[model samples]
Target chain A: MKTILSVENLIKKYKNFKAVDDLSFDVKKGEILGLLGPNGSGKSTTINCILSLLKFESGKITIFGCEMRPDAYDIKKDIGVVFQEVAVFEELNVIDNIDYFCGLYIKDKEYRKKCIDDAIKLVGLEDFKKFYPKQLSGGLLRRLNIACGIAHKPKLVFLDEPTVAVDPQSRNNILDGIKKLRDNGATIIYTTHYMEEVEILCDRVIIIDKGKIIASGTGDELKELSKIEEKVTVEIDSLDEKILEEIKQFKNVDEATYNNGILFITYKKGKNNLSSLIDYLKKVDVHYDKIYSERPTLNDVFLYLTGKELRD
Target chain B: MFLHNLKYSLKTLFKNKMLIFWTYAFPLILGTFFYLAFSNIENSEKLDIIDIAIVDNEEFNNSIALKESFRNLSGENEQEQLFNIKYVDLAEAKTLLENDEIAGYLLVEDSPKVIVKTSGINETILKYVTEEIIQNEDVLTNIIEEKLNSTVIDGSIEEFIQNVREDAISMLDTSSLQIRDITSKKLSYTMIEFYTLIAMTALYGGIIGMTAINQNLANMSNNGKRIAVSPTNRIKIIFSSLLSSFIVQIIGLFILFMYTVFALKVDYGNNFPMIILLSLTGSLAGLSLGLAVGTIFKINENLKTGIIIAFTMLGSFLSGMMGITMKYIIDTNAPIVNKLNPVNMITDGFYSLYYYTTYNRFYFNIISLLIFSLIMIILSVLALRRQKYDSI
Candidate 1:
């Protein structure tokens, strides 16, 4: 796949604080790349730099092999951006807003109508074509914002928390629309704090902290890089110190903590470790209530790498 | 793209109906009020007759001689009832004079004297009446000279003759006539001035408080940013805005002009087309002024309104809309500012229609408005060139 967008050593500073520092990434064509970071982690700065909305002190950004400048009109025409904050003309209705943004590129009225109709249908805002931004619900407004940005059928699109502060139904619709965009031969750069969204939508993910990319791989590959191997949870009516000691002696066990009648254990990397632990528990004559083990999730991988909770 | 921008501008304007009402409708209503007040003053002044009271205290059995003398003395034609003249007793006259029921009272005595409670006596009536009495004195003098020649032992009438001559001479000069006429004629632009003033008030009122539209433009996908990024020349956008402003100004000017012509019945002179042309040109100045102001001040609606008012009042004052020759010093030295003032150009344009039978000054005024408009448009475009959406 061809590289749709490439940024090298992007740096943005305000007075003394560096908003984006030494950030480099490449988004290939026809792939969904998730940009995952915590609050104040330079996510917005990086997106702004890519859009040429903010100036960078040191960086090389090439969109479709053209240098980005104030007059890079052609490049801008091919690129679509949905900001984290919902930005649409409040004066215009959903249909007109979509048409306006689409008309920026496709000037032909006939073609613009087709594109607008498609965009409206894609975002499930067909019922709200005549509604102004003020008249629409929050979730519906979010859908209108996404429809405006992607209406031009851009080769590469940037969705910056497009589903942020939306209801579950609207979030689901936006996720579905984003997946359809990727499937229709368009590359997408998605950013969000929702780990589940990234796991469900992104083909690959890049986790950044303190203005540097700490990890970059597919979801499963990044999960493998996490220090956690497996999570084992044992539910019991009550737990004695002797049973805790026996569970601690199991091989491949990393750490164990008991709280509120549930024993949580983290094990080292090993296959059949859960079966071995269960067999050992049976041989030790400990009455087991229930046992369960599962692989680390993307949330676990995020917490392990960023050392911070996802929702914080 | 032009349509789209205008559509959104109008939409935002509509969505905020209260804003549009204040910007467009409110000024129109206020303008109409001012128009009525000023037109009423003009109409009333023309139809009003000055009330005069004559307190006849002299018990003259030979009043015919006095009346006949007045007819032949003054050569200037006199209307029989120039002053709404009424004869009354001294007490009644004094009471009416004090109460302002009568304009003034003339007490005829050995020496005729007048008493006025107010200083603002009508000059035209005063001149006509004084001339009539002077003629009466001339006839009285001729009769006295005849009587003296025919009779004997009439002691020197020198003191009486001297007083009579002095009174006649005093009444002939009537110096106040020139000053009073000039003031009244100069004030003739009341209706025209009011119309232009309201047009300007409406324009500035709208332009100044148009915060809602400005804010919407600022928040949008950056019409400024997009123009900057696009291959489409930035000059086109500026031109488009100027063109749109020109359109709006024309509509405002039309409303004001129509109101003056049809509703107020103001005489715009034989060169009616020229007056419209001048008004249109002046509106360009208004538009440019609005653009320059909008560009310089980047904030919310309240600040925009305040700045608009400041500029409007400054322009109106310097244009001499508030008073005549108050800005004469500025008008002479800084002709550009005065000429560029939309209020001044509009008022002066109408004045040219009234005073000049030839189109010489009218042409000059039109050219002045045009040049002023051109300069403002150029400066506005320059100011607009640097316009960008700054984050607030």
Candidate 2:
């Protein structure tokens, strides 16, 4: 795949603090690249540096095989940025707002109108064409913001936590619309702290912490990097410390803990881990409600890699 | 592209009702209040007639010229009369002065003298009249002395005295002080208040300019961030936004000028075209000042707005927006401040239009305003040249 954006050795400093420290990444064409990080992990700073909206102490950014600068209007013409904060004009109605932002790129009036209409329909704002930003709810406003940003149908789009503070329904609508954009042949750089969103949409994920990329791979590959192979959870009416110690002594059991009415067990690597736990429960005559075993998810991988949850 | 950006900016600004209220409606409302407050003051003060007591004595009778001057001053037409003269005894005249019933009294002895209880406008006029009478008498005495020594006279003493009285009265009528009254322009003090109010309105365009800057600078707002990342040149965006703000502000100023001139009946001179031109230039200066301040600072929008408003108020205050005498006070004490202040320049431009027949002062003010605006625009563009922000 062709590289749409590449940043090499990008360093952005704020006085004594380095916001983006020697960050290097590339986003390929026609793929959704997820930049997952906690707050203040330099995701926004890095994106801004790539867009030339920020000044870096040292860096090189290239878009479409051309060096990017503040005045690189040709490269910027094909780029769209949807900020984490909704950035639509409050005084302008939905249609006019989208048209205005689209006009910034597509100057041809008739074509721009069609693009604006398509964007509005894509964001499911057909009923709110004449409604001002203040008149719309938070969810509908976020949709309008999305429509405004992507109205020009740029080939490269950066969606920076676009679903932050949005309702579940609107979040799903936005995600679906973003997927449609990707399927329509637009490369996307999606930034977020939600692991599930990356799992659902991103083709490749890069997890960053403290201005450095800690891990980058496909979802299954990241999961394989974690030490935990499986997690077995059991709900029991009563459990004794002797059984819990014996369960911990199992050859594949890495850790076991009993709290309240549930028994939790993590395995390093094991086959039939659930069956082994069930057999031990029966032997100890512990009455149980239910038991299940699941493979390690991206959340476990994130925690194992960074010692912090994605939401944290 | 410029027109396109300007079109959307204009639409957005017009839709901002709060900006509309502050820029247009508020000035009109305040102007109405000023009209109501000061309309009757000039008319009520016009009815006052100076009261003076003249001592009735033989010395007053001996000086026929002084008595005739006093008689002529008390004419049949009340509008023509300079004083309401009361012939009374010396004790009574002193009593009138003590009781504050008369401004002063005249003692027509060999050398005429005037007395008053305290100093005031009426007292000052009375003194001028008395001094003129004494000076004329001295001139007549000197002329008679010179004529008697030079040649013999054929006319009677009474006829000579009458002739001298007529000559003295004519000389008094043709004096520079009387010419000042004949050619005194109709000056309305309330007009200054209206001019300063318009100045304040012109400076209020700064708010619109600040809005433009806030909407265009990358670090100022989220909308700014989006625009900053767009393909358009930053200068183009700044220019278009300022042009849109200027268009809106000029329209607001025009409406305000029309309301003040027609509805409030403010005499902003007969030079309508010049007035409109000054309004446009003044509004531009105000807008440029706002743009410069907004671009130079990395503060929040509210703080920038506060700074703009406070600066405008300071300028207006120095230009006599609060009172008619403040402009004069500042001009007298700190003339450089008045010369540099944009609000003062705007008010003075309007004042020169109405008060002067020549456009020299008016054009000077206009040129000053243009220079001020140019400096602000240049500074704003320089400050905005940093397209990439260290932080947003």
**Residues A1-312, candidate 2, lDDT per residue (tens digit)?**
899989899899999898888888899999999999999999999999998888899989999999998899999899999999999888999989998889889889999999998998889999989999999989999999999899999999999999999899999999999999999999999999988899999999988888888889888888889999999999988877888888899988888998998899999995888887788778878878888888887878888988888788
- Residue A99 Cα positional deviation in candidate 2, in Å, after optimal superposition: 0.2
DockQ of 1: 0.15
What DockQ was computed for model 2? 0.61
For each candidate, the DockQ is 0.15, 0.61
The per-prediction tally of clashing pairs is 2, 0
True contacts kept of each: 0.17, 0.80
How well is each residue in B67-160 modelled by candidate 1, as lDDT tens digits?
A: 3323222213332223465568989988887787877766657655556765452532343344335434555567566656644346656655
lDDT string, candidate 1, A1-312, tens digits: 788889998887776787777888888889999998777777867876776666678989988877776457788777777877777767678887787667657768898898899889889998998899999999999999889888888888888888888999999999999999888888899988788899999999988776678888999899898877899988766777887887788777888888987889988785788888778767866666888988887778878887877667
Q: Kindly report which residue pairs in candidate 1 clash with one another.
A: B70-B136, B73-B135
Tell me the interface RMSD of every candidate, in Å: 4.2, 0.7
Model 2 alpha-carbon drift over 4 Å, by segment: B46-185
Would you give the TM-score of chain B in model 1? 0.54
TM-score on alpha carbons, each prediction: 0.69, 0.82
